[model samples]
Target: MKISLVAPAASLFAGVVSAATGPFLTAVDSQTWIIGNEIWNMTQGPKYGVKLYYKDHDCVGNAVGHYVSYNGAANDLAWTSARIVKNGTHSGVPFIDILFTAAEGDMHWVIFSNQHGSYQYFVNRALPTLGEFRTLWRLDNTTFPNGRTVTKDGVLPPLADYLPENKIQDETWRTPDGKGYITKYDWTSWILAQDFYGVYGEETGFGSWYINPGKDYYNGDETKQELMVHRESATGDAVQLNMLHGTHFMVSSSDVFPQGKMWGPWLWYLNDGSRSDALSRSKTEFASWPYPWLEDEPYQTRGSVSGQLTLSDGRPASHAAVFLGDTLPSNKSSLDQGSTYYYTATTDASGHFTIPHVRVGSYGLQAWSGNNSAIEDVSSTFTLPSLTVSKNKETDLGALTWKISEKKKLFQVGSFDRFSYGFAHGGDPWQHGLVSSCPANLTYRVGCSTTKDWCFGQSTKGNWTIKFWNPATANANKSATLIVSLAGYSSGSSSTIWVNDAVVGNLTSGSVGSDGLVTHGLASDPSLYRSATAAGEWRYFEFEVKPGVLKEGKNEVKFQLTRETQWHGFMWDAIKLEW
Candidate 1:
């Protein structure tokens, strides 16, 4: 079985809705109903207020009973005498009698007695179940006949102001361990007022008292030896008290002060079963003035690549292989099929690839094999400077380049996944085309290539340039260039270069010839560029940028690659960046 706890209905409306009735309603007309000799009614247009009535015992007649008023509205009320009801002799205290009424609006009643004290009752709209009740006065020695004079006025000083500021000295009692100890002292030397801490409790009767020592308490044999006690406070009058049994204190009002009456800032330690071993004296004073405390904010980082790819003819290209390399090629000889070092990827149908959670570092990029050919390839390298990628910020690498292939099939000859490549030539090609296989040095091949002309059949190769800019900052920008040169060729064929969507710039490829070089500028707002050259010999390609395009703060510049054909080998070299 399962049970759920809910707030009491009385607390919901603060006792506004009486359980006996629904709720009260106010009216304009004045009317009255007689409950015994007491006339009860609404006055002054049913406004919210409290009222008092003075009468002798016979005036109300009933000792205990309930009454209902029915003039213009209904009112449920109950009344009882001040007599206390007792339970088991010493088991618990007695209950006090009270009068209660439920009206439409806010109203309350105050009961006072010449011999007893005063108490206030409220029909709280905030606590419907437990009608509000507060004790305003209590019978004590100070307020008794020969005690301090009484005042009906409401003004009163703060409790702390009337209490002594000094700590009292006492005799300490030890526990079994000899470490745990307690001391007892009396406040009669400094206090002449009544005991304010002693308040009324339902179960303990009207005069029951509870004390807080603002420190720890102990229990043990006290008859063995007397322990000197030291005070913890800084000022006022002091008195010495003796500790008995480590639990009780021997205090006498007459022995410590001139006045026979004893008023106290009493101290007591409770040993209730649940808190026996863990219990300590209450720190009530410290609770009044608590200590102070500070708090901090939270922190995160992420990465991604733009979606989309562009061809050399300036059209969106889908399904292109894109690779990301960690380091730039060292020299022209490093752009070989089996010699180059980098990580790679392929673009989706939307020409986009997302690499999430990328670390901050340098990188080289390439794209290939889009239209099932080995003729088109583009490559570029860049560095993401020291950037602190905090939560919510995005670093964008604008674009990367891939060189185009000249063969009928856009890919070189044998380009598998983005990571590795193959060529169809055996001769030492310029763009670092490795010789993987050779049939008597005629049918030369590299990687997984089959034809010598497809791999080493070009004179000058294409070049790609990339310009990176950090839009997050004003002076954040940088540029990198990649050149792929072909050393041999049979004929000149137009090679298609596919730039990833993040690439921005002219889509046309510049021509190259034997022992000649072609250069292109990548210039576009919020974009980088990638391009491929026709099958041929090429040399000395350069990429430069105005300082400050790449920033020091959080920044991103992306370069993606795509191929016109599926199988082809592309080389990358002269990969350099200017600031």
Candidate 2:
């Protein structure tokens, strides 16, 4: 997909990690780490939850703690953390630990490592035992009228408990040949350990004894407790990986012992080799975990997510948005949005949405109609019981109903409201961010696309990209369409524009197709894009997205152009994603 070439999108997984700022208040309680003579810290706010701080070359004291770092947003969390190390993983860096509260209750430990490909896929090649940790969730519906509605009400059982073919890891880190076992951690608190470890463990080496943090009131007679996470590794594609559980120190009057687990056994993915094949096989093999997005990317994982959302009165919620959200809200949530929803899709006229290729997890299935901001009534924005999806499986939430205030018409999708696309990238200079190539009169914004900034009329292939976030469910019959046009280009010549893999139309003249797509250029207007003499003037072009093309979540649209002649001009007027 050449996906990694583009800049990272906005954060989607809000429940796991929230955006943070620097200068993490000196007033708050926090842990500071030293790495290569640098200080990094995560402020555990007294009022809020957590805030991360690190040494930035640009900050006032060369220490960044005052301003929020979009760099730490959900979408960029892996990249941001991986930049610290040499290699990257699907979730976070290997062995990097973070403490969090579960959606139900009790404190939990989850490490950021796994063989899972990219973000949501799995892979192979064993090395770090840290790679054995992945996440798992279970559906709980006890609160529903049916007595078993979908809900994220419990923890995923250990891999060995459910997957008969899975191998269990109970070996300790220091003692490799020995079976992995949790040991009592009489070490100091996490903050104290950070003080000793520094940012990258440049200080003392013993800090590894208690890496992941734990809670207070453990065993007895202690205000707080420390924990050391432990897990073993398994071989082969059929076996599910084990969760990393912590062993707290049991301190008696004299001797100490290791006992107590943070959570039941969970799972991680060891790629069967590539992500697509692994996720497909993972669902059938890893019976211990739930993976809702197993059916996306037909070319890859073949995981698909399809569901039907209905209104309270039993009417089809055409254009309703069905999305995935974390069962639990992290203390590090957005200060504005207030929810942990990450993935989304719009429903069709029949209230159906199909999004394929999602990773495994128990998610809060939520649906909404009207605009995203229009979700006011509790019924309009309620979570179905937790919906569980497995790899290469279709998670169909059949005809689920919600309470609505009034009946509404089918949602009318439209072009972006002159909004600047947040992301773009490729080999071309003008198409990328070399806005200086634009006319002197036109100012450029990093996230904005404009008329002066269009594809160069060079003969070689070049790519320009713009993306949109779709919150509506997938509509088999009502897929998203594009409203694209250009100005001031070669008069009377055809320039092809490709969306996805198909050439929808030509960018030569303003002509409307039977599908409602119109492609135009100054070739006919003689103005707009520039003077009639401009070499690459294409104006007022549009392409109707065929039904069943677009999906939910972040939709990236690319503009690939080629020059038929030496006509060196074209301006981007409208390259919008609509339906």
Q: In TM-score terms, which candidate is top? A: 2
- lDDT tens readout by residue for model 1, 1-579: 011123343352222222212112222222211111111211111222121111211111111111222111122332211212111111132212222333421222211112121212222222121111111111221111110101111111112232232211222233334433222221111111111222221222222122222111111111111111112122211111222111111110011111111111132111111121212222442342111110001101223344345555453445665544323442321122111112234566655665443323344444544323232343322223223323344445444333332222112222222221233432121111122221112221222434323332222233222222223443344343323332211121233332223332221123433332232321111000000111211222332233343455433222222212111223221122222
lDDT of each: 0.24, 0.30
Candidate 1 residue spans exceeding 4 A from truth: 1-301, 317-343, 360-437, 443-579
TM-scores for all candidates: the values are 0.20, 0.22
TM-score of 2: 0.22
**Residue range 1-579, candidate 2, lDDT tens digits:** 000111222222121123222111122112221111113223222112223222322111212121111111111111111112122233233332222222212222222332121112211121121111222111111110010001111111222332323222212122233322121111112211111110111121101111111111111111112221111122111111111211121111111211221222122222212323433443443442232222223222334567776667666777655656445342221111111113456677777788654545466565554322232122225466566657678877666777754522222122111111121211121111122233322222224544334332222234454454556675535745455433223233455655556566656544445554445543232121111111122233446667756565544555554543222334332344444
Give me the candidate number with maximum lDDT: 2
Q: What is the C-alpha RMSD of each candidate to the true structure, in Å?
A: 36.2, 25.5
What lDDT score goes with residue 272 in model 1?
A: 16
